[model samples]
Target: MAPGGPELLLIVGIAVLLFGAQKIPALARSIGESAGQFKKGQAQVEQELEEIKPDASGAGSAGAGTDAETDLES
Candidate 1:
């Protein structure tokens, strides 16, 4: 079951008590920066995958050439 208002309030209160108001902003900023870095890394990986995809197609054509050479040798 989902938390109701009181439960949500209690959780927030606990967070404030543990971290204090002054620290919360810094914590949030760090989390935002981390998330941004994660997104940047994910985009880099996607771009690399796109680049490799063309090489994969080229490899298939190269394999076909090898087969042709084998047939000529036979």
Candidate 2:
């Protein structure tokens, strides 16, 4: 289902042909930054979901607003 080594190499070769070797590093860096931003957003959403759910004792959601404010302030 996933690409093997040769397929990966072929993909890289195509990328090189399209973008050229000199631009590859910049493209990779941009992709890396985008991926990082995506991950951070995903983590924030998960944390918010956790805050919204009641605890084991069913005490109800707590501190969700304050946490948002903290994130905004930082």
Candidate 3:
């Protein structure tokens, strides 16, 4: 009566056998910390984007003003 993937059940059985139930809580806490760190990094990147000032031309397009003739003549 396996409801989901067999791989997950197999891994869980192995973990319970090797580490027992006592160590699982500590392992889960460590995983939670890793997940929190990932989320914090994602938030910092989004905050940096919001803090950035848009260019004066207002289109927010880089390499917009370069002219081929001016560049070639120089």
On residues 1-74, what C-alpha lDDT tens digit does candidate 2 reach at each position?
99999999999999999999999999999999999999999999999888766564354234666678889999
Q: How accurate is candidate 2 locally (lDDT)?
A: 0.89
Estimate TM-scores for all models.
Answer: 0.65, 0.70, 0.56
Clashing pairs in 1: none
Highest-scoring model, TM-score: 2
Q: Is candidate 2 or 3 superior in TM-score?
A: 2
Using TM-score as the measure, name the better of candidate 1 and candidate 2.
2
lDDT of 1 at 24: 83
lDDT of each: 0.94, 0.89, 0.81
Name the candidate that leads on lDDT. 1
- In the predicted model 3, the residue pairs found to clash are none
On a 0 to 100 scale, what is the lDDT of residue 47 in model 2? 94
Off by over 4 Å in 3: 1-3, 53-74
For every candidate, C-alpha RMSD to the true structure in Å: 5.5, 13.2, 7.1
- Candidate 1 global lDDT: 0.94
Position 46, candidate 2: lDDT: 99
Total clashes in model 2, counting residue pairs 3 or more apart in sequence or in different chains: 0
